[model samples]
Target: MTRPVVATIAALFKRGHVLLVRRANPPDAGRWGFPGGKVDLGESLEDAAVRELAEETGIQATAKQVFTAVDAFDHDESGVLRHHYVLVAVLCSWVSGKPLAGDDALEARWFPIEQLGSADLALSLDVEKVAKLGAQIHSNRAFELGF
Candidate 1:
């Protein structure tokens, strides 16, 4: 793509666990990560994150605030950039619904926060760091106070 596309990710946390989806598309196929996708025209960032979460994992969540932003640069074997996405990570609280793979996701489930970054799981590069930080942020009292 000529210009970097904007995307949003939901770092939804609940009861010490975080929701994840195994992506079924290129760029990071079969890798576990937060549910997200491109922000629709005129849609707010948090709204896009929540919408993607529900669409990809059948999970409903309340977007708290933006957690972080990261770049996903896809490169060909020849080291040429193919696609780049500016991903805004949103911290969210689990509201309802169980994760069921939909949209461009192959599988969906909740994983213990402690399992993040485990060698056994094939996660997108930033999943572990984002999740750990998100969980900590969600647990803080300020999270509930909406500060």
Candidate 2:
């Protein structure tokens, strides 16, 4: 039987903004979302998140924690499940590099938290909510550590 694919989405927060990528492939093509993809067979979630962030956005980041998980189910018009993904959201701290769209992304850049669900931008399902939570979590952590 087929199983839900496990993916890792990096919530790499930097300077009060979060990194996002405009997807170049389907499931959610053309929608802006956190950088991520299917996890490799032998890869850990943290590693996959960091790797995907780099692959899609050319941004180096360190995965600090697993913040949350989201279930994404794509159904065809006939109501058949086409894709089911368990997306693990990882909180990451920026290490280096600038946003350069690559891999499965058409564009990569940072968006301020306020702009996440703006009317002008097309965002993947639940992306804005997840991104906002990530920003909040990271901000809380930073404040706790006196950063």
Candidate 3:
């Protein structure tokens, strides 16, 4: 039986910038993405998000809200589904520590929202979409808060 993998993504933002990590694992290795990973058994999605973010970016943060869930599927040469993931993206605010590459991240850096689509960044489609949406949502939230 095939089961969909459950994962979480931390869309961490601070001072008009978002955190991005270059993946070090297969399925999209060396591609820029948010810091996140599969949700561990018996762990809450929010907790997993926090843990993954810290593990990948070395920055402690908490999920303030879940923004969206994205369906990601990888296909094999025969057109069969190799992997499917339901990734829940959570908007988080940085709590402490500096950004450092860890776990499945080859590198971690912060980029301004406008630069997310820059040619030099080489972001994946999904990453770009999520980053843009996350930035918009965060901006709206800040506006609501009168910040």
Candidate 4:
């Protein structure tokens, strides 16, 4: 029996920049995206996001809220779906430490969110859209709380 894979992604934003990592694994190898990985058994979504972020990038972060979720599917040449993942994007704030590529990441760096459209970034899946949405959500929350 095939089951949908659950994964988590962290959108770490600070000063108009978002932390991105180049994936070192398959299904989007070498593409830039958030630092995240599969949700371990008996782990909460937020916990998974935090753990994945720390595992992939040496940056310590605290997950605030879920920004969005996306469905990613890979198909074989015969149109058979090989893999599917339900990726939950969590908006997080940096708590401490600097980014260093580790685990499933090839490289890690911060990208200006405002320049996403014109930037020469090879983003994976719906990363650009998720980052934009996360920015909007963060902005709205800050405004609502008068921060």
Clashes of each: 0, 0, 0, 0
Superposition TM-score, candidate 3 onto the true structure: 0.92
Model 4 alpha-carbon miss at residue 79, Å: 4.4
lDDT of 4 by residue, 5-96 (tens): 99999988877888999999877889898898889899998999999999999989888998689998878779899899999999987899
Worst 10 residues of 2 by lDDT: 109-118
Where in model 4 is the C-alpha error above 4 Å?
A: 77-79, 144-147
lDDT of 3 by residue, 1-147 (tens): 999999999999888899999989856788888888899999988999999999998999888899888887878879889999899999997889898999999999998988977888877558878988898999898899897
- TM-score of model 2 vs. true structure: 0.95
Return the TM-score for each candidate structure.
Answer: 0.93, 0.95, 0.92, 0.92
Top TM-score: which candidate number? 2
lDDT agreement of model 4 with the native: 0.88
Question: Of models 1 and 3, which has the larger TM-score?
Answer: 1
Name the candidate, 2 or 4, with the larger lDDT value.
Answer: 2
Q: Rate the local accuracy (lDDT) of all candidates.
A: 0.91, 0.92, 0.88, 0.88
- Lowest summed-lDDT stretch of 10 residues in model 3? 116-125
Please provide, for model 1 over 1-147, each residue's C-alpha lDDT reduced to its tens digit, 9 standing for 90 to 100. Answer: 299999999998878898999999967999998999999999999999999999999888888899799999989889999999999999987788998999999999999999986899999988999998888888894567764
**Backbone clashes in model 4, listed as residue pairs:** none
